[model samples]
Target: MARNPERRNALLDAAIEVLTDEGARGLTFRAVDARAGTPTGTASNYFADRDALLAQTATRVNERMVPDPEHVASLMAAEPSRELIVHLMRDLVRRMTAERSGYLAMLELRLEATRRPALREELNRTVREQYDGNLQFHLASGLPGDADAMRVLYLAMTGLLVEHFTLPEMLSDTPEALDELVAVTVERIFPAA
Candidate 1:
């Protein structure tokens, strides 16, 4: 395995692009090397095998999608109310949409997980951990939502993101429309505090 963390990150980022553009079937060491503009076999030097590459790529996608720490702190500083939930949801949507390739790569990972048990386990662990962390944060911050509300909000927001990414034409892509969607989702999920 390569000891250069930067080069390894570059390979993982390239893997993300390859996953987004070519889907899991086309994810290969050669493809990642080509995408990274590194010499042939470069990816192989860093990753043990395709499964290793795929698993690490899933981690990379989550890393790319992590929200800015300062932004999250600022949002948490505000009083926990339904409006605050709106702000948080909007921020999530913005981050996920802005990192479109990462999200698409994740979707590719989900499809690939259906066929690969190891990848499926990896994906499940990461996704569940993320959900638990978010739920914990919401509860600790005194956000006006129970676990059920959080669950419903998760489903609604995920549906919005999927529709936005997969069929942009189906939903109005305007910022105002998106903001409204987030606002409405929060209102419906949390009720008036």
Candidate 2:
């Protein structure tokens, strides 16, 4: 089948929404087709099987959540500094907060990866790609942190994102408070000399 980019992307987006609502086991070609409001067999036509659909969905979720590279660069100062790190966190929190559903679907993908080796490998590679990119950016920018610090920062930011999205009431009630949390988290991850 000749794939139209728009249609294929729409189906993948709908798949994310389905995964977000139904979890890993609930995602199916038929479900995606139904959610996308497309004719039956549409999702199957685009993807070879369940695994392919899932791998693609995970990739799409990551792609959708990335903040603009230039925006990140602008905030990350040439020297490793708390301001740069806090700025970076602010951008990430804003993006993930706005795309709560996609992030939730990504969490679902994590559960699904545990049982499927192929899916696990795909998700690992996707995550590593993002990690490597951040490391590279940090290196080039002379950011104050080693690879290990970056990993810690990533995990801390992820935890904050999960809580902020899942039980928002449990988190800071105001945007400023959340930003303060982000600043504190980043500061802890990479303490000043």
Candidate 3:
């Protein structure tokens, strides 16, 4: 891998755009180069293979989507109460809605991972790392839940986010209704205090 960090990031962003718009099958070095408006073969200069390109694209999408530590800490400042959890869920879903393209790219990566062992291994590792990190954060913050609770919360949030981003009206009539849905989901999963 050539280490042109700036150029590599530009290529990764372009890859995400391609994935978001055309799905995994459409993600090609030439597509990325064209999307980035760079010279032909520019993406190939940085990526050794399609697997490497997809791996970097996934990493970049994850980086773009994760919230900053400070914001997460502020959200947790009120302690791990039901209401606080609901607010966090709302914010998370809202953030996913805003970053719909990135989320779509991630979905594309996940679907493509099913057929590529190397990509599957890497994506699985990344997913486990995120799950572990969330569990650790919950424990450190004194959240009232264990691994199973976290799993349920994770699934619930994933479902909510997918619905919000893909089929918004199915979840609610308006944005306020979506907030209520988040509140209800959190309350159900976390148990009211």
lDDT of each: 0.92, 0.87, 0.88
Off by over 4 Å in 2: 76-80
Superposed Cα deviation of residue 163, candidate 3 (Å):
1.6
- lDDT tens string, model 3, 17-121? 999999999999999999999999899999999999999898998888889889987888896677777787788877887788899999999999999999988
Which prediction has more favorable TM-score, 1 or 2?
1
Instruction: Report how far off residue 11 is in candidate 2 (Å).
Output: 0.3
- lDDT of the structure predicted as candidate 2: 0.87
How many clashes does each candidate structure show, in the order listed?
Answer: 0, 1, 0
Cα shift from native, residue 4, model 2 (Å):
1.6
Candidate 3 residue 6 Cα shift, in angstroms, is: 1.2
- What pairs collide in candidate 1? none
